[model samples]
Target: MKKIILYLMSAMLMVSLAACTPTQPKMETTPPDPQVMASTGGASDKVPDPNAEPMEIISVYSKNDNKTGLNQAMDAVDKLTAEAMVSKLIEYGVLEEGTKVLKYESADGIGTLDLSAVPQSGSGDDKLTIAAIGNTFIENFELDKLKLLVNGKNYSSGSIKQGDNDYLEYVKNYKEIK
Candidate 1:
């Protein structure tokens, strides 16, 4: 009789201990939809719609020291048609204060940007300023690449060309100046 009670008590203890073990919650593995990605400000490679009506939206980035600032969103403008958007970028502090866009036009999906003025001093500032303008045009418009001209001269004398990925690569690789 003692052996039977002992076995029963041992089994009860084992059962209780087994019940006390914790379980891991099941995890979800599905990707979110594109609308969810956009609303959350997640980066997406989806190109802008060319046929949609034009409006203005600010796409901002900081070159160094992650700091957030004020932003107001509206419909994105048609970059090809909106010359004022470049001026507005300077006004809104998206571009540097003195940056100027003399002309912005596209032919056969290749964009040509004429800048009346650009950052002259500080290698970091020059890189970021150029990248900001080029990236803004590339991201906003349906362009294969951009030809940047300053004061009616080719930026870097045929060194910056489309289809070779040099310009895009440079803009992307630009490290921020302190």
Candidate 2:
């Protein structure tokens, strides 16, 4: 009886030990939805980055210390067209105060933005300024990309410049959805 009790005790101890061991989590091999992935723009959708700019059609996203260009604490406006949105961004100091959109057009998820002025000093400012504008249009229009033109030519400011074939990509994150 003593031996049987001791064996049962050992068995219980082993069972408890086995139960305490960690197991690998089960993973599903389900394929991703093509439409969801495509619509989200896998690269830009990796993170959500809303900035402080007042968003109507779209808000500007400025580069922060982390280069994230996002702030959770921002407000959203409505009813502004794309051109008016850019004007508001200028008011917020994302672009040169006197900058003007020479032309703005978008169709089929592609936007062509022709501007009169862009930030020329401070590489950081230039990058964020361009990023703010491009990101604004991209998010609002659900665009694949924005082709930036300055004074009928490709955009160039500080250390930033776009080639004839180049298009603007998201600044690594997106604005908050209101």
lDDT for each candidate structure: 0.58, 0.71
In model 2, which runs have C-alpha deviations exceeding 4 angstroms? 1-57, 63-78, 174-178
TM-score versus the correct structure, for each prediction:
0.47, 0.57
Candidate 1 stretches with Cα past 4 Å from truth are: 1-54, 66-82, 92-99, 156-178
- Show how many residue pairs clash in every candidate, following the order shown: 1, 1
- Write model 2 residue lDDT over 1-178, tens digit each, in one string: 9999999999999999999999999886997877655564557666545754554534555545564354322335656566676666766667767778788888888889888877677555566667777777787677899998988999886577678899987766543211
Question: What range of 10 consecutive residues in model 1 has the weakest lDDT sum?
Answer: 66-75
Tens digits of per-residue lDDT, candidate 1, 1-178, equal: 9999999999999999999989788786888876656454444555788997866564533344432222333335545343655665565455656667777778887788777765454444455555656666665675677777777666652222323333432244434322
